[model samples]
Target: MANASNLVIFDIAANNITGPVPNNFGSLRNLKWLNLGFNPLGVNQQPNDLGFINSLVNCTSLCYLNINGNGLTGDLPSSIVNLSITMTELHMYGNHIYGKIPSEIVKLVNMTVLELAYNFLTGSIPDSIGELPNLGKLDLGSNNISGAIPTSISNITQLVALNLESNMLQGSIPTGLLNISTLEVLSLGDNNLGGVITEEIVGNSSQCVFLYLNQNFFSGPLPSNIGRLKHLVQLNVSNNKLTGDIPATLGDCVMLEELYMQGNLFEGEIPLSLKSLKSLALLDLSNNNVSGSIPGFIKGFHLIKFLNLSHNTLEGEVPKDGLFSNMSAFSVLGNSLLCGGIQALDLPRCQVKISRNKRKTFSLRIILLLVLLPLGSLFVCLAFIFYQYRKSKKMNGSVAVLHDQQFPRLSYQDLLLATNEFSPGNLIGEGKYGSVYKGLLESPTRTVAVKVLNVEVRGASKSFLAECETLRNIRHRNLIKIMTACSSTDFKGNDFKALVFEFLINGSLDNWLHPGPYQENERNLTLLQRLDISIDIAMGVDYLHHHSHTSIIHCVIKPSNILLDEEFVARVSDIGLARFSFFNTSNINQAQSSSTGVRGTVGYVPPGNF
Candidate 1:
């Protein structure tokens, strides 16, 4: 082996070599590179087996060292501080190595790339790390590193990337980091860091392209000068304590493609200037206090694909053109005040005015009035006779038609007992027509949701009848199953009308898309999960529209109307507005046209003159 003392490079990587490494490698005095990475020997070595690293320190010309993905155990050898002065790169990630980094690492003055991520390393990052004048990238992410980042890191003027994400680091970011104009990526997500992000923190850094500060405790508004980062492509500051209005200057980031600011305290209307972000593809502003109408100009976005505005105070009409046309790609639930969009949104319709020619309107009215006077008198006389006949028939009484339907004979007492006497604590959700309570039935040994109607409202009884009529005739795996309907009197002798359904423990899609404070913070649907849910919803709607015994139009089809069972399978529910129609094209159009006012919730009426 002494004959190889003049060797300048050794490249044995990704081979299945095993057994302890040789310790006489120092004989290769002129060795400049050693790449013994991705080998079983490196991955499964004893604590005293890495003595080769000590031997390599005598190789004055060694400049590069890579032993990553080796699953090696034991502390980083302290002799690393005695590496060659020309050493510039070191990669030792994806291992079981523990213990604090030796502060003497500062001796590697020429180091440029140092990656120690995905390991068991603990303790605070040593402050001397900044003494490496030419270091360009420093990654310590996904480790047990803790404590505040040393302020001296600002001294690394040549650094281009710094990642310390998924650590136990605490305290605010050092203000000096803003002065590093060469930094292109800085990730500090999933940490315990807290404190305000002042204006100066992001007022500089013109070259930054990606910034992630999510899952922290940072508060206050984003710096007004945030637009200064002309190269930024993605920015995420979600799950924080940030407050105040979003800076309109964000529009200045013309190159920005994604922005996540959900789960914050931001208020005020979405800045109109955001319309200038021509490159934006995803925008999440859910779980905030944003108000006002969704801007019509949003329809002009050239590339927006995903948007979430749920759990906010937004109101007025939802835009139907452009991205808003796809209900599966966006959400507007939890905004009870919103109205008027595509029919799929199931929102109430906005009133339209009749535009008439003022000059001929008066003459036209007079002409019609004179011609209809005699006909009106005869029509009224016949209507009075028909009313008297109907009154007499009603007084004679009739059989209970609602109870004769093919459903379980559930009485009011059964429901009351199942839902713990309809206690408020048993209530799970509330809607315009009624309150839904979670209940347990002993005979069936199953859980159920009991929707008890608020008959005191003007149209509550009609809604109950509509739901019963619709549920009894439809059957689909993706549609809510009706167990029974109760129409008996309550203890107070008031009219009691309720519907029992198969209980879905996971609640509605609305809650999952916009979780409140009490909901799981880390629960999120992946792309595959979302696609499956979308397919389920589409199949359910398809059956209602075409395969049912009678064609049915689901008047409202929002997230709140979609329930999820234990397996997360979607089910279309809330059929109070469903209307049966003929399968014939002409009859379908006639049915839609004759409907006077909106039948669905606000923000979801179909478009057209009707």
Candidate 2:
């Protein structure tokens, strides 16, 4: 290879080549381009595996070099500064190169593209990086690089794409970077950057097509003139501390295809102006304080794919047309005021309201009819007496007994014995409120899951009561059945509360979806089996939200809360955070606020809850 001194272009990428890269590349003085990417060129040969770069310095005519994804290990040699001054592009990402980027790299005066991402490179980016007058793209993402982004980067007038995501970089974004008219893609997500995103940053970036600012600590409202970037194709600002109403002008971005603003503090109704986004495909506004009815315009977007508006204050009827008809395409969960969708949603029916004029006319006729019937007063007294009698029977104790006639009353001792004195071997699952144990009952010769509340937890007792109340009157095949409950003092005289449920041999849906090491054989599920489980879960949630005696919201509806039976039937369990809605459709907002606070497991819970 050293004798090939006249070689001008050495191209061998994306091959199965392995072993150390030859260090004789400097012999090719006329080498103008070299490409060796996507090959295992440097595997375990450590101590300075990238020393071959030192030999490339002799190739004065080299203008382009690409050696990405070669499993190469070692610090980026400082000798790189001696590379050909004519070098315009250098691609060394997806390798094990570490150490600080040499500040003297500015010597490569004509360099344009520099990609060093997906490596272990540390230290802040050199301020001199902007000295390259012709540089266009710079990508240093997915590295351990820390400290503030260099403010000098804005000097690169010709910059088109800048990606610094997945780094340990801190501090607010530099305003000058947004002023470049040629800039199109700006991704700085998954960082510690914070502060208000100024209007100039949004309004000036009129040519930006893809912008990502998600998973950061950026606070304050977005610029009201965000719609100035009419060329935007995708915009993501999710998982931030941003607050205030979503700007109405955002609808002017007619070219937008994907917009994500979930996990933020944005409030008020989803702006009607968004109806103009006919090309939108994916839209997520979940976990916010957004209110009002879901806009009907969403149904007109024929190209729409996924839409999640869960955990919001949205009210009124959910549209049943277009994307709404496909249950898999969208989710409106946690919106207590929402009703009237497809049967699969299980929301209460939307009631028609009487007009003011019609109400007055009806009242006059009712008053006249009452005056003609004195016997109506007698029947009212009889109904009141019957109601009082039932109320008296229900005041037995603090622990409300459910189906007492069918299930036997259980005590603390009964559960202790059933679970073999709460042995570690009997334990099955554990959660924030309590632990669950697998046990056997002698009387019925049945196996069961015993959920024992840890009353020491601040809200354990309340959760216990809530679970009992939710399960007391609701009965559905897809819902877990409570055989009996024990709210008595233990043998040691401490308060003990436990709920007994029929044990499902197949375990939780979480286990089935993401099996542990011990569950190797339980990992695979056919597409049909998965569909059946999904339908079963949807049916269970529908019953809670619509068909039950009272409207119930299973505050936590994650995979862990779903169980599979012997026949693979899904059963929704863990109603410890369930909230009851007794108010009519018109008072849905009041019902939603009646809960003490946002409750549920993190990640699974809506962002608004946090």
Candidate topping TM-score = 2
Q: Tell me the tens digit of each residue's lDDT in model 2 across 1-610.
A: 7678899999999988996888888889999999999998877757778988999999999999999998899998999999999999999999998899989999999999999999999999999998988989999999999999898998899999999999999999988888887899999999999999988667487779899999999999999989898778999999999999999999988779999999999999999999878689999999999999888888877888999999999999999988999999999999999989999999999999899999999999899888866777878999999988975564434463455667678777778899999999999999987899999999878999999989798877666766776677789999999997877787787878888999999999889888898865847778758976886887788788777888876778898999999999999998767766787633544565323243787778645444
Colliding pairs, model 2: none
Cα TM-score of candidate 1? 0.57
- Tens-digit lDDT string for candidate 1 (441-475): 98868899999888798777667766776778789
**Among all windows of ten consecutive residues in candidate 1, which has the lowest summed lDDT?**
394-403
Worst 10 residues of 2 by lDDT: 589-598
- Residue 486, candidate 2: how far off, in angstroms? 95
TM-score between model 2 and native: 0.59
| lDDT of each candidate versus the true structure | 0.84, 0.87
Q: Cα-based RMSD of the predictions, in order?
A: 22.7, 20.5
Error of 1 at 183 (Å): 0.9
